[model samples]
Target: MKRFAFALWLSAISLNAYADSANCHQKANTPESIAATMDQALQLKQQLNSQPDPVVILVRQGQDMSSRHLTWSHAGYAMRQPNGDWRVYHNLNTCGTAESALYIQGLYEFLADDLVNQSIAVLRPRSDIATALQTLLHSAIKLNLFHSPRYNLIAWPFSGPYQNSNGWLLEVFARANDAQVWSRNDARRWLQLQGYQPSIVSAGTFERLGAKLFTPNVFTDDQPTELLRKGNVGLNSGDSVIRFIAHYSRAIPGCEHQNLGESVCVYLSPGAKRREKIKNRPSRREKIKNRPFYANRAACKSAYLRRQVVPCGPSSRIIPISVRRSRAASAAAQSFALRASRRC
Candidate 1:
C-alpha cells in the first residue's frame, strides 16, 4: 500500500510538470525579441503623445498569418488618459480559449503579448468620431453593450453567438460613427450602409474541420451557410476594417492620409523603410502597398504591472493603407480585468 501511494505522488508531480510545459501562452522571449518589442512600444508612445485626438484605433501583428495573406492579427482602442498616459482597451481571448474578456492594458502590456512581428497601425478618426470613441471607451456600459463572452477566431462580421476581437472593434467603431448604432445588429446595418466590406477567408473542408475539432477558439457556424458551402468565410479583419474606414471617410493624398475626418498611418520598421522606401513620398495607396502597418504612441507617464518608466523617444516611421478595393484576405486575430475582480 505504501509503495502504491509513493507511485501516485510521483505521477502527480510528472503531470504537473507536463502541464506547465504544455501551457499554450508560453512565449520565447529571447533578448533580441524583447528589445524589438520595446523598440516598437517606445516609438508608439512618442506618436501617441503628439496626437491631438484623445483616442485612436491601434492595430498590431499579434500573429504571423502571412500564409493566410493577412498582415495584422489584432486591433484595439488606445485612449489617452487624463494623466497623459495611454491605455489600450480591447477584448482578448483567454489563452486561445473560446471564452474572452475585455482588458484595459498599458501600451507595453499590449505590445508585449506574443507577437508575430513588430508591426502596428494607427487609425485616427475624425475629430467628432474620436470624441465619440473616447466617451465610449470610458463608459463600461456602452462597451459591454455589444460584447459577447462567446468568442471565435473567425466570427462572421454580421452574425452572433460569437464575436471575434476585430468584429467587436468594428461594431464599436460603427457605434461611434453613427449614433443610431445601439445594438450589434444596428452596428452591422450601419456598417453595410457605409459600404463596409468584410474580407473572405478561404479554407477547405478538411482544414476547417480540423480547426474546429482541435481548436476550440475557431467555429464556422456563425458564417453564412452559402459561404460555408463554397469554403469561403466572410469575417472581420484588420485590413478590411482599415480599408473600409479609409474609403468610407475618403482617403487623403499622402503619408498622413486623411479620411473625410480621420487620419491613418501605417508604421514601418527602419529596415523595411529602407528596402521599400520610395524616391519621394507616394500617394496613400502607393504607400499602403509599399509599407507595413503601425505608428508609435505617446510617452509612458506612469507604469503599471511591472517595470518603472518606459523609455520613449522619436516616433517610428509610418505608412498608410490604400482606400481602394483589393482582393479579400483574412487573418486570425481582449477585456478589462479590474471590474471582474470586484464582482468576484
Candidate 2:
C-alpha cells in the first residue's frame, strides 16, 4: 500500500512539473489599455468590412518579440459569416499548460489578448485560395487533422511531437492549397515543394537554457542540433506564414497598421495597385438594393433589437427607418449560429 501511494505521488509530481504555468505578464487593464484594445478591434472590423473576400489571415502583435526582431507574434483565420459578422479561428493554450484548444472568438475578444501594441497585419490570400480555406475551416474533422494539443512555442515546421499556433495554421493552409495533403506529413511535403520557409530566431546559450528551464510551451529539441549550437532556431511564425502565402498566391500586402495611429499598405504587384486605385464605390444599383426596406422606424428598431443587424451597406450610415435589405440568408448562415455554440 505504501509503494502504491508513493507511485501515485510521483505521478502527481510529474504531471505538475510538465504543467508549468504558461501565462506571461500581461498589460494591466488601465483605461489606456482598454481603449487600445477597443481601437484595434474597431479598426480591424472596418478594414475587414472593406475587403470583398470573406476570409483573410489576421496577424496580431500580441507579444513583444522585438528582441527577436519579429513584428507579429500570432496568426489566425478571420472569417466573415454569412450574416456579415466576423469571427477569428485560432489555437490557444489551455490554462497555461502545454496543451491547447481551438478557439472561435470575435474581433473584440481576439484583440483583448495581452497585446504589446495596437498594431496588426492582414494578409489577403487569392480569391480561389481564400475560398478553399473557407471551405476547410467549415469542415469538422479536417480542421483538427493538423492540430496537436501538445503546444510548443517554437515547434519545428516539418516534423515534431508538438505544434505551435502558427505551425497549425501553416499546415491547414497547406492542406487547403493542395488537396492531396490529407495528413500532416503530406502537408509538410507540399509546403516544402512550395518553398515555404520558417522564420529564424536567435537564442543564445543562456537564453536557451533559461527558456528550457522556465517556460512551459517552449521547446528546442525539435530543432536541428547544429542550428541550436549556432544559436539560430527556425520556427513557424506569423511573418513566415505571411511570406509563404504571399509567394504561393502572390497575395498583395493588405495593411499594416501600427500602434502610433499610422496605417501603411503596400501592394507588391502592379495589378494590386491598379485594383486599389479603382475605388470600390457602390454602384447606383447596389445602393438601391442595399437600401433599408422597413416600413417605419418602430419596425427597424424592433429588428435591430432582435440582433438582426446585418447586410448593412458599405456606407453603413444611420438613416431614418430603412433597415438593411432583408434577403433570405443562405444555408451556411442558418447553420453558423448553431456552430457558434459548439466547443472549439
Candidate 3:
C-alpha cells in the first residue's frame, strides 16, 4: 500500500483495454474466455495488491498489485497467484520490488477459497491451515464466539489483554475451508473430528479484522503461541501488563499497533470471566503460574461454531447471529478485550 499506492497509478491507465462490458457473471469458459479469465485474475491481483488489508507485516505495502505471482510448489521456483492463472517468478528469501509484490488486500484474502479454488491444486496449505484452525478452535469453543458463524475468524477486532487470544482458531479454519470467516463453533468441532486438534500458541493476529486499536502493554511476536507475560506476571509489573497487552494485539485481527508496549494507550473491555481470570492470575493475590487454573502458556484463544453445519455461501446470502449480538452480555457490560504488543 505505502509503496504501490503512488508508484503504479496504473489501474486507471490500464482499464482502457476492455472497452465493452460483457455481463459474463457466469464462470468463463473457452480458450479466449479463459484468456479473459487470466486477465480478470490479473485485474483481481492488481486490485488486491493495490489495497491490501495486511494482517501480517510481511505482506508489506505498495508491492506490485499484478507483478507478484506464485508458480506453485508442484511446479518449480515460480509461484502462482491465489488465482489459478497469472504466474509470476520471484525469490523467496527476498522481499520483492514494487513491480513484483501484489497488494493483496487483507493478507487473509490471499488465504481464502474464492481466491483459492479447489482446482488450482498448486499450493495446498489446507493441512497446515486446517490444523491451526482446529487447534485454535479447541480453546475458542469455550468463548462467546461459540455459536456465531460470521464472527469466527475476526471475532474480537478490539479487545483488552484478557480477551486478546481467543479467535486464532477461526482464522485457521477459514483458511482451511477457503471461507474468509467461519459461521459456527460446530465447524471448529467438525475440523477437530478431522484430526485438526489445533492447540498451537504461534503468535499472529488472532483475527483477520478490520478495526485497529492502539494500546500500550501489548507486543506481537513471531512465535505461534501467544506469550501474555514477556517475563512473569505481577500486579505492579508494568512490563507484564505490557506483554499481556501485546498478546491481546496478536489475538485481534487487522490490528497493527504493537510497538507501544507501555502506557495506557487503549481502553478495551474484558469480559467478566477474563476480568476474573486476570484478577486471579497476576494480581497481588497470587502468581499467575500458581493459580489452580493457571494457563501456563497464556496462549490466548477464541470460540467456534455450534453443532449446526452451515454451508459456505456468499457473505450476504443468509443471516446468522454475530459476536455483537449473541455474546452472553448485559446491556451495561461489554465483550471486548484489550491488548498491546509491538515490535518495540
lDDT of each: 0.64, 0.65, 0.25
When summed lDDT is taken over every stretch of 10 residues in candidate 2, the lowest stretch is 12-21
Which candidate number would show the highest lDDT if scored against the true structure?
A: 2
TM-score per model over all chains: 0.68, 0.65, 0.18
Error of 3 at 260 (Å): 36
Q: Residue 267's C-alpha lDDT in candidate 2?
A: 20
lDDT of 3 by residue, 246-321 (tens): 3222232232222443311221112323554565666544442232221211211111122122433222111122
lDDT tens readout by residue for model 1, 1-344:
43243233223211221111123655668998778767767778887786576988777765545555766667888998888888998877765367777878888777776554555677777778888899899899999997888877778887668887777888899999888889999988888877888878676676676666556667788888888899777777777867766543323335543232244676655544564556355887875454432223211211111212333333322222222222332111001122221222
Task: Please identify which of the two predictions, 2 or 3, would achieve the higher lDDT against the true structure.
Answer: 2
Q: What lDDT does candidate 3 reach at residue 136?
A: 38
Off by over 4 Å in 2: 1-36, 249-344
Which of 1 and 2 is the better model by lDDT? 2
Better of 1 and 3 by TM-score: 1
The list of candidate 3 runs beyond 4 A from truth reads: 1-183, 197-212, 215-344
Tell me the tens digit of each residue's lDDT in model 2 across 23-139: 344446899767766665776677778868778887766555555566666788989988777898887765445788787888887767655454556767778888999998898
Highest TM-score: which candidate? 1
